[model samples]
Structures are given as structure tokens and as C-alpha cells.
Target chain A: MSALLEVEGLVKHYHVRGGGGLFGAPVVLKAVDGVSFAIPAGRTLGLVGESGCGKSTTARLVLGTLARDDGQVMFDGEPVGSVRDARWRSQRRAMQMVYQDPLSALDRRLTVGKQVMEPALVHGLGAAAERHEKALSIMDAVGLSSRFFDRYPHELSGGQRQRVVLARALILSPKLLVCDEPISALDVSIQAQVINLLVDLQEKFSLTYLFISHDLKVVRQVAHEVAVMYLGRVVERGDPEALFHAPAHPYTQALVGAIPTPRTRGRARAALQGDPPSPINTPPGCSFHPRCPRAEARCRSEAPLLRPLDDGRFAACHFPVLSTPAREAA
Target chain B: MTVPLIELKDLTVDFPVGGNWVRALHGVSLTIRRGEALGLVGESGSGKSVTWLAATKLLPAKARIDGEVLLDGKPIQGLTRDQMAGVRGKRVALIFQDPTSSLNPVHRVGTQIAESVRLHRGFDAAAARAEAKRLLDRVHIPSAARRLDDYPHELSGGTNQRVMIAMALAGEPDLLVADEPTTALDVTIQAQILDLLAEMRRETGMALVLISHDLGIVADITDRVAVMYAGRIVEEAPVDALFDDPRHPYTQGLLAALPDVAGPRRRLTAIPGQVPNPAALPPGCAFAPRCPAAISGCVTAIPSLDAVAADRRTACFRAGHATPWEIAA
Candidate 1:
């Protein structure tokens, strides 16, 4: 199947005052640098990374909410140059974004029904009565009962508020959904509820998702393909099932190993040393070298470009974890 | 052979809300041995945090704490204010989730640590400063002396957390209560903090009460775990048994709901509803509505914690097959 959304060479840099030696020249923080990915129709591309790793920036760039410094975006074979184009307005009807905090994202003044129906009304897709019907249907699809239609944002539970958010996004009948840390604010059981809902909604709506989250477990469960980002760059990309088992990049290995799972009970996990360095002062060669355990003089001087390996996966690491089972077990 | 480091016997806490006593904890009993790590797992309003806050007398003035709090087998509930205060700060230190808020933004982190050291250790300024640097170094903060002069804002979340741990250590507390300590941090940063906590516990031999909602995280470090619902302990077991063969339906439900990163992909079986409002909890079991194995008796009668398998206790009628509390019609 043809890819529904395609992004190539996406870059977004923010200029901030200070950090320039002697002169007060601005420091350009590369929020997203040279990122590329494609999501096939009815598929999900999970972007997993910690804070300041540019996953959210990449998501916004993919959705065209934030202007990209340099990139190309193609939706259904049509190039999207700028959001200013009149055609982009109509194109936005096929795309939507679900933010992390459902409560803050919503207006307390508006009722759930009106909030869900606002997208349909804004697009001028139907009359007031038709919009009402669509909102009810969408709310029902997201597991929100009609009783919540007139309820304020505060009256609803965290999971219920998120369902309302999903209902609002789905009301637009968007083909592509960019969900950024959508369930991170929720509790465990409630997070599972939202995860199951997302899965069911995908199967029912045949939706394409660019799921951006730091939750590796949820990402592995919901995403067909996973991309591990480090300091504004994609370090590894591959299928979740195999990739998680035998992570190719040392960074990916650290990430996978660092995850607190009951399966690896007796094994000693050498956690990644420190937090990701500030994006503004990203390291000279590989940005992850400062925290990587296997860093060498070569890693300090030359950055390894993300390239394919014999294992049918890609990693931006010179000394990668061998994918072969024999080598990995030893 | 001696008494546990701390113990809570039939503890209950109630706050006067609208002239009526609204219960926060319903008869919680737990023991923390010296150098042992205990995990308290529950959602918000589950009384896991309250159990510690009440034990430490950190709850608000109006919170009515009933039952016995033991320190070295002596009932501390009857202790005088000055005695309890000394026992609280010098022996049992508390760390919160947001260290930034707990820390003074204006003061240098070094000064904060030194202050804690001086207060707990009764050290002079120069000695306190030296001890502060040593504590920082013990927490694995690189260049501890240099980072001491930096303000809380100057440090990363991970680094700020290390400082918090250092300050908590300055007390040389016998038992440290950490409430959702790593929840606010990023995953990789959280891993670093968790590693530091584990290493520090090994070095200090201090009892650690880790209050968190993350089951995987709790399972990773704690030797034993207590699962709480509404305002009571639903189950208590060794960490391995709790994860492997959870008996309580609520515990089983929680495990089934988790998404496994390294395992096969399966549809998550989420519990049907949200946690009940503590103010208007249903009669009998607070978790009956959410429990998959709830029975008719579970609707009206509360279940008391009963011993189940060896080293395990569950407050469920189904798990232990023990009779629940008798009630009037």
C-alpha cells in the first residue's frame, strides 16, 4: 500500500540568546534535525524518546502545525509546501492532533458535546443538528456515554476527558492522527483503557497514526514500526517485535534494557549514565556519545549516519549490538 | 530479633470534611524492617501515601490519626511533640515527587544539603559543608563540590533529584519515605534516579518505603509490596509472588492491564471503571465494582486482611476464602 503520510529531511531549529563565546551571538538549538519517516495507510510509526529529543517537534512538523526549517511533506501523493495555501485548510480536515494533557487542551467553559462537534462546525461539514448527531456518534465510538455530553471538562475523569479529546479529533473524520504522549498523564488501568480504545479505533476507522510517546511498552504494543530518537535525530528504526528483542544501536539497547520489566529479573541492567545533553549544546560527533557506555575515540570524532544493516533494520551506531542470536546470547 | 524499624498497627486517618469525618485510611498495618525496601502501589487516593504521612506525623493538624505508631516497639502516638519532632527529622526523612518545589530556589543546592546536615547531624558550618559535599558525591553526582554552589534551577531534573537524595541522606535517617519520587522525570532520567536510589540503599542500609503507582518500577527494587485500594491494603506479598501469582482480583486486574514491552503483543484487558470516590465509596469492598471476581457478599461487607499463602495476605473474600466482616441489615 502507498504511504498516506511521508516526511523527509525535516528540520526545526530555534534561536536563543547567549551561549556564544565572547560575542552575544544567538545559539541555534536544533530541535529536529534531518528526520525522515513514512506511515503507510492504516499503520502507526511509534516515535520513542525522552524529553528534549525532538519527537514532539517532529510530530508538529509532520502535522504542519509548526513550520519546518527544512523538509518535504507529502500526503496522499500531494506535496504540502506551506500551511498558508488555501488547499491546506481543506487538507487539514483529513488530519488531526491529540495532545498530551486532555484537561488543559479543553476549554472548561465548553461542554463535551459542543467541543466534539466544534470541529464539524468549523469545517462547515454539516448543519447544527447534523453536527450534534456526529458528535454523539463519535463520543459513543470513544466509549463516552451520552450522559457526558453536557458535562464540563472538570466533571469527567482523566480517561473520560481523553475520550472526549479523541471524540473531538475523530469527529473531523481525519485519516491521520498525531497522538503526542496521549496517555502519559493517566493512571495504569486508565492508560490501558485508552490504549485499547486507540487500537479498536484504528481497526474501525482504518487510521494512520504517528504515535509520539516516551512509553516504550505501549509503543511496542500499538505501533507496527518503531523509531528511537536521540537529541533531534532518529538513531534506530525497525519493527518493534524483533527490534526490541535485539536492539541494533547501543542507545536503543540501553533504552530497551533500562525499561523496568519483570522478564529480566536476574540480569543486571547498566542504565544509561546521564540525561540527554541540552539540544542547544549537542555533542560534536554522535550526540549520545557522552552518555553511551561503549563510546570510543572514533565515536567522539565521526558520527555514524543511520544506515541499513544485514538484519533488515537501521541504526546510527558504529559499534552496534549484534542482531544475531548466537552473538547476543553470549 | 528486635522490633521492626517502624510499624503501623491498625492505623486509620480521617479528616473532618464538612463536619463529618471522611476517612483516608482504613486500618492499615505494616512493618518496615531495618535496611528493607518496601513498595506501596496504588492509584491516587488509595491511602498508600497517607499511611506514611500519618506514621511520620506529617499529615495536617486536623487529620485525626487513630491507632499505634511504633518506633523501636514503643508507641510513638503517645510521644511528646519535641520527642516526635526529633524522631521525625533525625531518623525518618521524606522526599517528595517534585524536588524543585521541595527545594528552595534561591538557596544554592549545596547550602540546602549543608543545612539539612547541620540540622540532623548537629555539625558546624565548615563540617556541614564538607559532609554535604560527601553526601552529594555518595549520590554519584559528578564534581559534587562544583555543583553544590549551583541553585536548584541550574540543575537538571535528574541532578536535582540526586541533590534531594543527598539531602535526604544528610539526615542519616533509618527509614526514608519517597513519594512518587521519579514520576515527574523522563524515562531515561528516571532510570538514572532509580539506579541511584538502589545504590544508596545498599550503601546506607536505610529502610526505604517507595510509594509509587508504577508496578514495574516497584517490582524492580522492592523486596516486598503492598497493594492498596480506596483506603485500605488490598494485598501484601513478596514482590515475586505478588507479580507472579497475584491472588486478589484487583491485583490480578492491575497486572492484566499492564502492557509488556518484551513479551508478545496482546489486547490489554483494562479494568472496566475508574477508581471509586473515597468520599462515597461503595459498601463492603471498595474495589468490588472493579473486581472481576467480586461476589454478592462483597457488595455489603468489608473484607479484613487475612493470611493466604505463606508470606502473603489479601483482604479479599475470594482470595483467602476467609469470612468478611459481619454487618447489620
Candidate 2:
């Protein structure tokens, strides 16, 4: 299958005045620097990272909510432009975003049905009757009943509110969905419900997803392929099973080992020490070296580029946990 | 067994909301033995935190609390505000999910820890400061002495949590209640915090009450586990037993809902529907509305917690014959 979305060398930086008096030279904070990836049609690519690791920024950049400093984002074989551009406005009908908090994403004053119908109305897809019909059908698809149609967002439960958000995102019949921590704010049971809903919806709609989350377990369940990001860089990318079972990057290994598994009781696993360095003044060489357990002297001064392995995985590491020759053979 | 360190019997807490009462806790009974770690697992609004708050007399004045709270077989329910204050930090230390907000951001971390040490240990400034440094060192904060001078904001979330641990330890309390302590941290940082807590518990022999929504976390840290739903604990058992043979339908559904990292991927059997509002809870079992194994009779009468096996309790009409458990078997 061909790639539905292709991102190349995406870079986004913020400028803040500091280091001197009132009007000092601005320091550039590279929120997302030289990030690149692609998502095939009707597949999910999970982005796993810590809070300050630019996952959300990448989502915004893809959705055209935030302009990129450099790089290209091509969707459906067409170049995506600024949000205000006429072509981009029309192109946005095929893309939609779902955030971590549904309450914040939804408007309090409007009923869920109205909010869901608003997208269809804004895009001028159909008549009023047709829009209402489309909204209710989409709501039913997401498991929201008719009783909740007129209820405001506050009246709904967290899981129900999330369903309303999903209904709104699907009302326009978008082909690509950018979900940023879509289930993080929910209870474990409710999170599972939403995740299952997403999976069901993906199958029914044949949707492509850029799933960004910090929960590796949930990501593993949903994503066919996974990318591990650290300080505005994709350190590792591969199939979820292989990447999780035998992670090549030290950072990925630490992340996979850190998850508290119920089956492994009192198992001793290496935990990464220290906090991720500030993106404002990221480390000289590898950003993960400060917290990496197997940091060599060479890792301190030289940045490793993401290199491809024989197993169709990519990792940016000088000394991978797995031997290079064996991994290549596999 | 030698008068458990802390025991709560038939504890009920209610709060007034717009002239109506919200039943936050419904006759919660639990025991924490000395040097034992008990995990309380539940969703939000499940009264897991309220149970601890009411046990420690930390609830607001508007809350009407009824039931017995005993500390070493001594009644502590009717204690005066000052008396409760005396029991709070010196005997039982409580750490919240967000350490940054719990700490005084403006004050130096060392001074904050020293203040607690002085209040509980009756030490002078110099002695308290010395003891505070020792506590920080115990939590494994790097450059302990220098870090003592840093403010809460200067330190990372993991470091701030470490400082919170140090402050909690300054009182040298016999029992420590950590409520979602690592929820706000990163995965790797969460592991470090969990390991540190385990190490500290081993060294001091302090009884621990770990409250979290993550089953994996609770399973890893606690010796026993309690599953709460809608202000009531539906199941209680040894950690291994609970994970291996959960009798309650709610517990079984929860365990099955969790996606295993090392297992085959399949559709999660998520429990349907949301938790009922406390004010408008159904007459019978709170989980009946969402329980897959719920029978018709489950809607009319509340199921009291019954002993299902040795050291295991379950509150479900179909405890042994639940469909989910049968599938697991």
C-alpha cells in the first residue's frame, strides 16, 4: 500500500527572549527538530514519548494548527499548506484531531449533537436534515445513545464525552485521525472502552491514525508500527512486537522495561536515572546520553544518526542492546 | 493479629452538595497490619482517597463521618483538631499525586523538610537541618546537600517527588499513605519512584497504603489488593490471588481489559457504561448496571462482602460462577 501521509525533516522552534536585559537575544527552543515519518493508508503509527518530547507539536504540525519552520507534510499525494490557505482549508476536511481532554475540546454551550453536526455544517457538506442524520449515525457508531443527543458536554461522563468527541471528528468523514493522548485522562476501564471504540471505528472507516501517547501498553495494543521519540527526535521506529520485545535503543529498552507488568513480580529491571534535559539547552551530543545507562565516552560527544537495520527497523544508537550482526540476520 | 497498626470499621462519609448528600464512602471496613503494604485500586470517585482522608480526620467540616477508626486498637475518631494534627504527620504521613503543588514552592526544600522534622521530632534548627539532609540522602537524591537549597520548581518532577518522600520520612511515621504518587511522572521516573518506595519500606518496616488506579502498579507494590467501585470495595484478596483468581465480575473485567505487553493482542472486554453518580446510586450493587455477570436479583439487594476463600472477600451475587471467571478457568 502507498503512504497516505509523508512528513520529511519537520522542524519547529520557539524563540524566547532571555540571557540578558529586557530585550536580549532570543534563545531558540527546538520543540521539534528534523523529525520525519510516514503513515500508510488505513494504518496506525504510534508516537511514544515523554511530555516535553514534541509529540503534541508533531500532531499540531501535521494538522496545520502550527506552522513548521522547515520540512514538508504531504497528505494524500498533495502538499499541505498553511491553515489559512484555501487549498489547506479544503484539505482539512479529510483530517481531524482528537485531544486528551474531551471536555476542553468540546464547547460547553452546545449540545453534543449540535457539536457533532457543526463540522458538517461548517464544511457545507449537506442540507440541515442530512447533517442531523449524519451526526446521529456517527454518534451511534461511537456508542452514544439517543438519550445523550441533546445533553451538554458537562452532563456526560468522561467516556461519553470522549465518544462525543469521536463522533464530531468522524462527522466530516475524515480519512486521517490525529489522536493525542486520546485515552490518558480517562479511568482504566473507560480508557479501554475508548480504545476499543477507536479500533472499531478504524476498521469500519478504514482510517489512518497518528496515535500519540505516553502509555506504551495501550500503544502496543493499537499500533502496528511504533516510533520512540526523545527530545524532538525519533530515536527508534519499528514493528511494535519486535520493537517492544527486543528494543535496540537504550532509551527504548529502558522505557519497555519500566512498565510495571503484573506477571513479573519482584523482577529487577534497569530504571533510567535523572530527568530528560530541558529542550531549551539540549545536550551537546545525544540528548538521551545524560540519562542512558550504557552511555559510552563516544556517545557523549557524537550524535548518532538513525540507521536502518536488516529487520526493517531504524535506531539512532552507537551501541544497541542487541548485537548488530544478529539483528541484521533476523 | 496483634492489633493491626490501623483499622477502619464500617466507615461512612457523606458530603452536603446543594442541600443533598453525596455518599462518598459506604461502610468501608479495612485493616492494615504493621509493616504490610496494602493496595487500594479503583477508578475516580470510588472513595479510595476519601477513605484515607476520613480515617485521618482530614475531611472537611461539612462532611458527616460515621464509623470507628482505630490506631493500634485505640479509638481516634473523636479526637480534637489539635489531637488529629498530632496524629497526622508524626504517626501517619500522607503524600499526594502532585508533589509540586503539595510542597511550598518558595521555601527551600531543606527548610521545608526541617520544619516537619522540628515539629515531629522536637529538634532545634541545626539538628533538624542535619536530619533533613539525612532523609534526603535516604531517598537517593543526588548531591543531597546542594539539592536541599533548591526550590521545588528548580528540581524536575522526579526530584521534587523525591523531596516529598524525604519530607514524608522526616516525621518517621509508622504508616505512609501514598495516593497515586507516581501518576504525574514519566514511565521511567515512575519505576524509580516505585523502587525507592519499596526500598524505603523494606528498610524502615513502615506500613504502606498504596492507592492507585493502575492495576499493574498496585500488583507490583502491595502484598494485598482491594478493588473498589462506586464507594465500596467489591473484592479483597492477596495480590497474587486477586490477579490469578479474581472472583468479582468487576475485578475480572478490569484484569481482562488491561492489554498485556507480552501476550497476544485481542479485543479488550471493557466493562460497559460509566460509574454511577454518588448522589444517585442504584439501590442494589453499585456495579450491577455494568457487570457482565449481573443477574436480575442483583439490581434489588446490595451484596455484602462475603468470604469467598481464605483471606479473600468478594461482594458479588455470582462470585464463583461469574461468566468471566469461568472463561479464565
Task: Quote the B-chain TM-score, candidate 2.
Answer: 0.98
DockQ of candidate 2 is 0.57
Residue pairs clashing, model 1: B284-B301
RMSD of each: 3.7, 2.4
- The TM-score between candidate 1 and the true structure equals 0.96
Once superposed on the true structure, which residue ranges of model 1 sit more than 4 Å away at CA?
A19-24, A324-330, B320-329
Candidate 2 lDDT score at position A278: 84
For model 1, how does the per-residue alpha-carbon lDDT over B133-205 read when each residue is reduced to its tens digit?
9999998999988999999988898889889999998988998899999988987778888888888899889
Write candidate 1's Cα lDDT for A142-245 as tens digits: 99999999999999999999999999999989999999999999988899899999999999999999999998999987999999999899999999976788
Q: Candidate 2's C-alpha lDDT?
A: 0.90
Best by DockQ: 2
DockQ values for all predictions?
Answer: 0.53, 0.57
Best by TM-score: 2
lDDT, candidates in the order shown = 0.88, 0.90
